[model samples]
Target chain A: MKKGRLERFLESDVDNILYWVSIFVVVLTAIIYVAQIWFVNYTGRYDLLECRLKTMTGINCPGCGGTRALKSLFKGDIFSSLYYNAFATYGAIIYILFFVTQTLERITKGKIKGIKFKMVYLWIAIGVLVIQYLLKFIIPGYKI
Target chain B: MDNNFNEEPNYTGEVVGEPKESGKAKASMICGIIGVVLCVIGCFCCIGYAGVPLAIIAIVMAMMSKNETDGELTQQAKIGLICGIAALLVLVLGFVIGFVIGFASAFTGA
Candidate 1:
């Protein structure tokens, strides 16, 4: 049977799709990071999205300090990043891995293999987030 | 050699010989990609509420595709399923925690 146009395009253009998607992700992240810097500088506040959980419940969510953590990491404050949200470090690492894989795939014309442990990596990320939440709840003075 | 040249082309047989690829698998892969992208956007922009529905949709499509696919295509569906589930879990967990805490504080007057 003759393949549909969409199917043919998907099968044939996967490399190009992956390459462009990677670029898009990287560019978006960069833009967000830059915007965050400007927002913090002008507003004198780190968090743009006020945590609803914190505000309504007076308790931190699992991802409460993730933004501040990323901001600190981007600003090169490693200790502060960990202090605000340890999960941010893991998130950053995963993002970096994704960026590297995508960039490499684009450069190598799909010859260079990208990380294939798609589900495993995702599960690991989820596990880390859960662990971070548990640590914050169980350990005194361990803030998330 | 002359007998082979005399044979008629079996167009119907040719069409039937090739297996039809399932659209479900393709839809599953597309939904998964969209779900992951939206999750990233939601996380970065702090608008996770907007991403939850899309993630759920992605998970549903991926599961539907998973049953129809095999091998590498199955792997793609699995990736989508995992991504969608992860995004949904994160959002749900946050809301659940927030509500629980809110109720606890209300009862305790703390």
Candidate 2:
């Protein structure tokens, strides 16, 4: 069967695509983090970006505090990350493990089989999010 | 593509020429489904950006699956890839629209 250009690219350029995408993410993260620092220094009273849902609805959404959690994670403060948003904190840990495992499998050329990414794992993660969501409302004096 | 990746028959007990799916492909499919679902959940409020990451994950997993396995996406993985792309486009579009609105409001003092 003949292949189209897009098909050929997808088949042959998987590594290149992943590489560029990862590079883009890293660069974007760096830019956003730097901008955030500058904004904080300049404003001193407000964050540069605000959560739309919280601002509009006066209630925390499912992913509230995710940005703070990510910032704390980037700063290597795991406890603060978890305090900000347990879901994002745990999700980052899981993603790091997944990424490391993927890199190892590629480096080893599949000689060492890493643990399979199971559907059950995602379900468990969702379960944790649901628990946290309920607790945010149930517990008094809990930060959003 | 290594046809012998599957050492045993699947739950259906069907031993075909194609082996069972690698974890990456399965993850791709799962992430794609999640991405689309999240995008469909109304890309307003806090949910607007939720699907973007999942879509990226889906596409990445599909690419990795192709790289490690058959050099071609599995049927499910291809579906995942398409869904991921669709979700990404929708979410990004919503983000752009939101940004434009915010900018206009700030300029107009509204």
What TM-score quantifies how close candidate 2 is to the native fold? 0.56
The positional error of residue A2 in candidate 2, measured at the CA in angstroms, is 14
Candidate 2 chain B: worst 10 consecutive residues by lDDT? B40-49
Clash-forming residue pairs, model 2: none
The digit string of per-residue lDDT tens for model 1 on A19-113 reads 44445545665676577678878988865556665665577765678778878989999888877877667768766776688678768988987
In candidate 2, residue A86 scores what lDDT?
80
What's the alpha carbon RMSD for model 2?
Answer: 8.0
Error of 2 at B50 (Å): 7.7
lDDT of 2 by residue, B28-83 (tens): 67768667655643355343345666688888877777865559888767977998
TM-score top scorer: 2
Ten-residue stretch with the least lDDT total in model 1 chain B: B14-23
Residue B68's lDDT in candidate 2: 59
